[model samples]
Target: MAEELRLFAGVDAGASRTALVLGDATGRILSRVRGGPGILRPGRAGAVAERIAGLLKQALGASGPVASLEALVIGAAGAGREAERGALEEELRRRVESRAVLVTTDAAVALQSAFPEGPGIVLSAGTGSIAIGRNREGTVYRVGGWGRQFGDEGSAYSLARAGLAAVAKAEDGRGPKTLLTARMLEAAGKVSVEELIAWARLARPQRVAALAPVVCRAAAEDPVASLLVQAAAAELAHHVEALRERLSDFAIPVALSGGLLVKGSAVRDALVARLKAAEPPVNLVDRGVDPASGALALALGLRP
Candidate 1:
């Protein structure tokens, strides 16, 4: 009998959710499973590591022991640093018996997810925004993804933040009056600016990002909202351009990934328009890019 087809696994461990896929050595995907958040917080590596193993067991349908897995590759946020990767890897090793386990950044897997073995840049705009690229030399470069408090420009968090600021400015007479005050309040389901403030103080990043669509929709009729949207696009464009500068002297393919780059998106359209105007412009990939597949590629030893 042919040596039983070896099994490999891949996981895309995102902040809000995690995606897991199992496949044979031939790369024929066998199972797909989704689970809770897989964020690799500073001190919570063990918990997240447990979640990863759980994902594997689930993908295995509770039939085979994890030792049967030939290898596993996972990409996650907070795993860019050596210490973070080490911590998670150490914890995962204790719980898993796979022949090999690889830990990498969500950005790295995203670039692989988009370009695979080729060299390209991936711009991700979601609850947070970041741009990562790989060049011919296999040297990986990154531009943004600093998180909300520091950077994360062009992210939904940033857009929502700017919207809230606009509301405050308009309300305080510090800036031009606009529809944001009314719309933001409505989106937050609060009757007054005061109530919105109360909600904001306790709200999480995802909740704050939830307000971005309201601002995006209001952009059509509100100058302030419009400016916010333009600035967001400009920020995202800057992310791509900055990566382009470091990746190569010549143009490189740029792939747009993340939840925010949906079809007909104002931010997506505006960013595309701006990049298209650049000298040599940006060559974009029209198809969807999936980071889970990228992780699977790594697991299969298919990535360069």
Candidate 2:
């Protein structure tokens, strides 16, 4: 008789994109799918759940009908609170045909991806910024990630917002002129400040965060853009420092993940440089693993 096949699925539901991966018990990937964000905002839980369900269905269908998932794990942004995670887990359980379903913050999975089963830290800066660390005893500590209204200082949204503010200041002669003004004008197709302001009022956070690359491109030569990038790095460093303080006094490995930090951007370089020059000196991992892969590892009981 042939051995029975068992499957698992892992979902990384971020603020900008949602990625799902289907794998067998042997740790072989069967299928993968991508979709819009599945991070449940205050009033968008239902819609996000539907989107995630659809992505799962697509992944399973693409893989084959013979396979049945035994477990599914999801690591989602905006699921920091236990209540929020419970709600998302219930919603996903109803949608997926799996025996067990687990949900956790995206940071948790990212940490697992980086360290597998030990003490370490994960610093993520995409649409938002957060630093999460785990001690040898398995206690987790977090910093930043208060949300866009009050926090998210080192994130793409923060960088884009600063870039736009610089454009406004330069237009009003309150700040020095920079290349960001022309870049913003070109990107937004706005002729005047009034037009830009009108568009911004209706723009979503993801749309605004999309401009971070433009700011990064100008940072090498543009003084205003350079300062903004430096500030973002400082904020990220602050989060790391706070997390470090909560952990043991010994140096620990720090993993950098998310778009802003993982990608080849000025902010990434600046943050890395800053961390390296810190008093205690940071041990940053050069490569970052995907959070979805970490979710899969958790589903397979490879890591706690």
TM-score, every prediction: 0.94, 0.94
lDDT value, residue 70 of candidate 2: 83
The residue pairs found clashing in candidate 1 are none
Residue 275 C-alpha lDDT in model 1: 91
Tens digit of lDDT per residue, candidate 2, span 1-304?
Answer: 1233677888899998999888888777888899987876666656767888898889878866744578888888987888888887777777767888888888888888888887899999999988888988888988988889899899999999999888888989999988988887788888887687678768998988888888998999899999999999999999998888888744888989888875678999999999999988998876566899888888888322
Q: For model 1, where is the 10-residue window of minimal lDDT?
A: 61-70
- List, residue by residue over 76-190, the lDDT tens digit for candidate 1: 8767688989899899889987778889988888888788876788999887888999888888999888778899899998999899988887888899999989888888899
User: Cα RMSDs of all predictions?
Assistant: 2.0, 1.9
The C-alpha stretches of model 2 lying farther than 4 A from their native spots are: 1-4, 66-68, 302-304
- Score residue 164 of candidate 2 by CA lDDT: 89
Against the true structure, candidate 1 has what lDDT? 0.84
Off by over 4 Å in 1: 1-4, 62-66, 302-304
- lDDT score for candidate 2 against the true structure: 0.84
